[model samples]
Target: MTTKTSQGRFFEDYRLGETIAHAIPRTLSGGERALYHALYPSRFALTSSDEFARACGLPAAPLDGLIAFHTVFGKSVPDISLNAVANLGYGEGHFRRSVHPGDTLRAESEVIGLRQNSNGKSGVVWVRTSGRNQRDEVVLDYVRWVMVRKGDFDAPAPPPHIPTLAATVKAADLRVPKGLDFSAYDFGQAGEPYRWGDYAVGEMIDHVDGVTIEEAEHMMATRLWQNTARVHFDATLRPDGKRLIYGGHVISIARALSFNGLANVQLIVGLNAGAHANPCFAGDTVTAWSEVLDKAETAVPGVGALRLRLVARKGGAPFRLRGEDGTYLPEVLLDLDYWALVPN
Candidate 1:
């Protein structure tokens, strides 16, 4: 008899420089967009209406950038994080192209670095994953590191290798969609009059809204993305006996809530860095706020970029991020820095 089953790749099983082609190629449709909007408070005009997108010069509305991201991230779960402790952090992420409905997407990952924990029970694995469309055009790419459990404690650890990553994706490197012109952008249709120039560096905006995570919705979102992480689905996987809400869920929720103050930020073009500062579980009420970190002009007429720090917290006052020890406070759930395109 032969055993044919996958227990997923443990820390000791990974080898640096190896590439893994993830399983399942997903073809997205407008239904995905509808479900995504239903799952969160997303209301970006460009993605919400075809007419608005056409008015902005795009042939049609593109799916939310995170939809591509989560799909790719989900495909990698079985091969990358099926036996993981936590998905730690992300860096050097860029949305190279707009993803539209009817496009089929797939993902592959290269193990870029590795480091074993002193505890001998777990280790970190870093990978650069690329999501591509049917035409082989890269849609999204990013580096992520996850802490994975070591199946065999006695297995010899590999020499540690950590990769250097960029602190931010430069404005020059951002890819503004072709034909995206905000010259005649309708502030009335967009639901906001604020433009790129209206925002100032160092200014903070409190979203002033909160959404409680429900067990059912979280489960649906994880399954929708094909994320098979045990901690997110199996109650017995954690000592607390509560399912962990997917971090992307928190990100989408925060981004949607930001519509209150950032209605004109129609596209997320670059992701500088992100961290799941703390674990989020069902029943947690998530709130968000944003601070303008920097701003730049794009070559596209009427388009500019804003570097923002979007922080999501379970509780506590806005603008308070780190503590005296230089670590995230207990209330902080996410600290994400990214660049978005807005009208000039």
Candidate 2:
């Protein structure tokens, strides 16, 4: 038998400025939409009803922003983070277009930075990835860094090159879907009465809901995205003998929880920053909260953008993100900052 299988690339294999076109383009459908809603407690009106979407000027109900994000992120996992210890952080992520069913999506990433850890066992690889639709239109762009294992301890460290990433995507640069007209947005249909002017900076909202993780659910969701990361699937990969949940899984659930108070906040346009504070395992009950970080008006009439800090926790008190020591608390699972479209 001719033996042929891929072992995946290690940290030593990456070179700065190298562009990788990830394999396996995916054509999305209503199946993914149904599975996503089944995996997470999602109930956004624009994505749930075609009438609601058209009322807001969209041709049809679009998939959740995170769905598109996870699909794109999943395409790079086998090549970028198959042996990753953890995905460290995300910055400068922007959703350029809304994806409806029947759209084909592909991903490409460029190695922007590399730094070997002093221990020589691992290194951090920073990459900027772009998700493009079949038309070659870029749907999303973001920067992420992950801690990847080094296959050879004796391999010399690559020259350190850390890319300077922007802290936030500028409001002006945020792409509002063409023909998006919220002037006719219906509050009753959308589920929340609060408009853009209602959210004041520094206000905190406890979503007041919790969902315990199920190993099967996370695995199913990860498979739905076609993510091939070993850490999320192989229980024996971790010393604890438990599979790790995908970080995007937590993000989707957290965003879903936010709908309790932010129901009318539709369309995530920008991801300023995010961090997975701790590893998530099955049976952990996750709750969430949100803070109004900032607000800005958009060129689109009757539309505004809100900068929000969404926090997911296992069992922490509401509104607590970090401890006095300026580090994320042990119970904190995720800290995500992003911009969403809301009625002005």
Candidate 3:
């Protein structure tokens, strides 16, 4: 008898410096926009109206930043984290170009670092992945690390080669899209009067909105992104008999909730760091808040950058993050530091 089923790559199959060209190019469309709005409470004016986008000097409304992130992340799952224990963290992310409807996207990754866990049952693999459009232009680029299970626990561990990643993406490295002008931006139409100059560092805003996660919505979102992580869909995968929610799902909802406070924050240009501090499951009501970390002027005519720390939590006092020991509180689900573009 012959069996012909691939079980995906285990920790032993990975090597530093290996370049993987992920398969299955996806062409996005209006359907994605519709589904995203249905799944989350996204109401950013620029992404909601073509006319609003045009006034901001864009040809059309670009897909939500998280949609572009999920598409790129999904393509690398099979090659990178199909047999993963957990998707660990993200760092140094940037959107180089806006993704519009009808654009085809693909992904490629290069293994940059590796480390064997002390338990010897799993290892962490770090890869820098790039999502490119049909024009072969990179739309998104980021580095993420995942903890993957080892098919053979007895296999010799690979020498550790952890790369020194930057703690934050430099403001100068941020990509302001070509012809992106906010001089004519309308505050009323955009739903917020705050601009780059209006936000001061050290200020915190509690986005007082919450959304309870639903099983059906998460499944639909995972399928939409073509994400094949078993833990997100298979209840039997864990001993708890509950399906794990995708981290990106938490990110999108948190970002959507932030709109109430960060209404005029237009483009997500850089993701400096992020961590899924705790597991999020269905029925958990998620809320978010943001702290202005830093600010910088951009070379763009009317654009500026605001560095922020976006936090997602459940059932916690507002603005609380870490506990006494300097670790994230049990109620905290995500801690993301990023930079967004706004009109100066």
Candidate 4:
């Protein structure tokens, strides 16, 4: 079996209410857990320390919800974002259930709307993607929009039109999965030395550290997600016999990397944009870079807001995410924009 060349589609190819079932299945495991913890000192009260989880009424320590979201969203990259120019926004996201370690994840996408650009060169596509487990239960859901290049157009005359999205999910709109409760939360081991007030606008720092991924790790991650796309797992699936690492793995890795500098960031508030600029395979070591984008005040007094651009690349370079040609190198895997709850 071989991975499809799926060049993906442009704005012209999508219609309202059209669904796109992605072709990949992924699985999460202990390694993912270790990576998650190492990448961000994320104790989260529920994700780390099985002992704490049991006290919290969980059967065991659960995988972080954000990790699950990253895995589920990563599955859509090949089918939805391969040709995207910009990821406009994400909203209406709900974590409907808790995900534990060793659970398998799968994803599917539905096109909700599309609008063509008058320039005939680009357009935007809106999609709602849902993630399910091996048991076929809904675990995550969200709406995202992307700017895609136009594939073809016979005649173009209408002026370009674009859509807008909500800045944040309202409190009433937050669906914090059935089993999550802060009532039993443990505050000691989460590993942050500061709260909201420690942060100020215009701060930047490097999330110091590197992670080296292997074939087995990437394959296991892809399979766990039920991301059936062969290239991610099957060495024999490629003519070169090289198994491709899942793009989302790199995203998760990079996000975790941000924990080093953005240590006080408590919650992922917004996903402004993201990109898997290049393909990453096993055997490449990853390093991270980050830049503060913006900041704001939040409802949680001890927590302020920080928006950042996090990047992941192969090896220890000058942290230049792009190559000489301005294209992402095969070593570069992620260009992500997100908002987090951090120290003020």
Candidate 5:
């Protein structure tokens, strides 16, 4: 009998410069938005109400940016990281356009970098993934690298080819949604009165809330995105027998927690860099903090951009990130840097 099952591509199978188009395009609807909001404490006015969005010059409320991101990332998992050890980091991420209900999204990725780990059992693969809509317009573009186990230990190592990525996405390159105007924004409705000018370059904010991770919710979120990474679903894959929480889950949670202090940050347009500093499991109470790294003005009237560092940790005093040796503390779960559009 012939085997029709795919065991998934291992590290030795990836070729630099090869492009893979992921399967099963997803068409999102209000159901996705509803479920996303139910899963996370998301309440940004622009995405929460059509009236609010129209008031800001948009036709209707758009899906949260992370909804598009997770959808795109999930589509690529089977082709890119089905046999992975871990999804390491992301850089140069840009949300090119707003994603709304009724749009069908698909993803394609190009392998740009490859490096074998010294252990010979695993290697890192970097790919630039682009998510496009049914119209073939790019919605999101980003680079992510993952460590994947090798199916065959004796396979010859591929020559390392790491692509140099931008350390930060220049403000000039950010794509503010067309017609996004906060000139007549309702400060009371947004949940916070803080405007872009209110934030200083070095200011820090403790989000002042914590949500204990629940296994059911994490599983639901991963399945909602169609993310089929074994580590996220199969406890037997890890030595500890714990299903690894999806990094994006932590990101969404952190972003939701940020609403307390950053309620007026209406939209996320750029992701400079991100790292899953440590593995997260169910039952860990996640908390977050943010630092105003920098700010910039956009051509869009009434819109400004804020460069922020959002950190999610299991527990510790706020503002503590890296340790004395310049490594993330064990309690730190996520270190994310991104740019958001705010009322100027």
Candidate 6:
């Protein structure tokens, strides 16, 4: 008998100290690489040219580290926080290795902490998730928490381990992708001249634009993330015959759209937390907006630091986020908090 029954998740299912393995393995390909560059317009030549990469000392152009992070993180959504009330924060994030095309990625989560709300209705669930490539090599590791419903109010609340997270990562903490030689970097063709100092804390900007998605686009993305979940591609997987969208696609699109205002964001330093606030499907016109959360200084000359929140939505007035109830709107598809290095 098929045991598939989903009407959206609520906070009650997570168990502290228990592990939940997210199904679906994804295998990224050239198509995803192409889409990633197109979406972000990133000028990190190493990602755009094999020749440049060879000169810098890599086997070939590598996928964006953010792309790999998004792919790995997106895999946990369904099993962990589909019904989450809020993403608490992220900690212990480190990229242990690089993932290239043709590499299949799989993810697993270990619940490390849990705390029931005093009201007894909902609680926080924390997990340290690790993403691994086909070779079983670690690609990334991070901690995240979400407010979930109690499966049973009588169930004892799990212990909470809210690890201390850095407010801003130093440039020395950056894992500059190997073989990346900025010495030969082309700033003119790299897109923008604004370095780190250009950004300030608490600033907000709307990246005004939209890109209509197609089936081929999403299916390819789902596959690249090695997220084999049928919902993201197979039309027959669901009763409605609708192709489920890949969460990573939304992440990449939103990050790319964030470029409008975060154009000078040179390096990603920290990932505080993230969420796909809602489901996304084909034919959806995705748009993006950003808010500066914090700022810091990196060791690199002329490099500044900016923490940003990037949100993606379907369509409508270029308005900011808020629900009718004064909460963040449900139409919002993402709530990603991360840090980037920009021009000083």
**Local distance difference test values of all predictions, in order:** 0.96, 0.95, 0.94, 0.67, 0.96, 0.69
Tens digits of per-residue lDDT, candidate 4, 142-227, equal 88777777777664533343445565444433333333333444445556565545555555567778888877777766655545
**Per-model TM against the reference:** 0.99, 0.99, 0.99, 0.63, 0.99, 0.68
Comparing 2 with 5 on lDDT, the higher-scoring candidate is 5
Report the lDDT tens digits of candidate 1 across residue range 60-100: 99999999999999999999999999999999999999999
lDDT of 2 by residue, 1-344 (tens): 77698878899999999999999999999999999999999999989889989988889999998999999999999999999999999999999999999999999999999999989999999999999999999999999999999999899999999999888999999999998999899998888899999999999999999999999999999999999999999999998999999999999999999999999899999999999999999999999999999999999989999999999999979988888999999999999999999999
Clashes of 1: 0
**Higher-TM-score candidate among 4 and 6?**
6
* Residue lDDT tens for model 5, 37-148: 9999999999999999999999999999999999999999999999999999999999999999999999999999999999999999999999999999999999999999
- Residue 14 CA error for candidate 2 (Å)? 0.2
Give the higher-TM-score candidate: 3 or 6.
3
Off by over 4 Å in 6: 1-15, 18-32, 35-46, 51-60, 70-92, 101-107, 114-125, 132-137, 144-174, 178-184, 230-244, 300-304, 317-319, 323-326
lDDT of 3 by residue, 1-344 (tens): 88898789899999999999999999999899999999999999888999999998899999988899999999999899888889889999999999999999999999999999999999999999999999999999999999999999999999999999999999999999888899899999999898888888999999999999999999999999999988898899899999999999999999999999899887899999999999999999999999999999989988999999999998888899998999999999999999998889
Off by over 4 Å in 2: none
Which is the winner by lDDT between candidate 4 and candidate 6?
A: 6
Best-to-worst order by lDDT is 5, 1, 2, 3, 6, 4
Query: Positional deviation of 285 in candidate 5, in angstroms?
Result: 0.5
How big is the positional error of residue 277 in model 4, measured in Å on the Cα after superposition? 1.5
Q: State, as a TM-score between 0 and 1, how close model 3 is to the true structure.
A: 0.99
Question: Which scores greater on lDDT, model 1 or model 4?
Answer: 1
Better of 1 and 4 by TM-score: 1
Question: Model 4, residue 123: displacement in angstroms?
Answer: 11
| Residue 201, candidate 5: alpha-carbon lDDT | 98
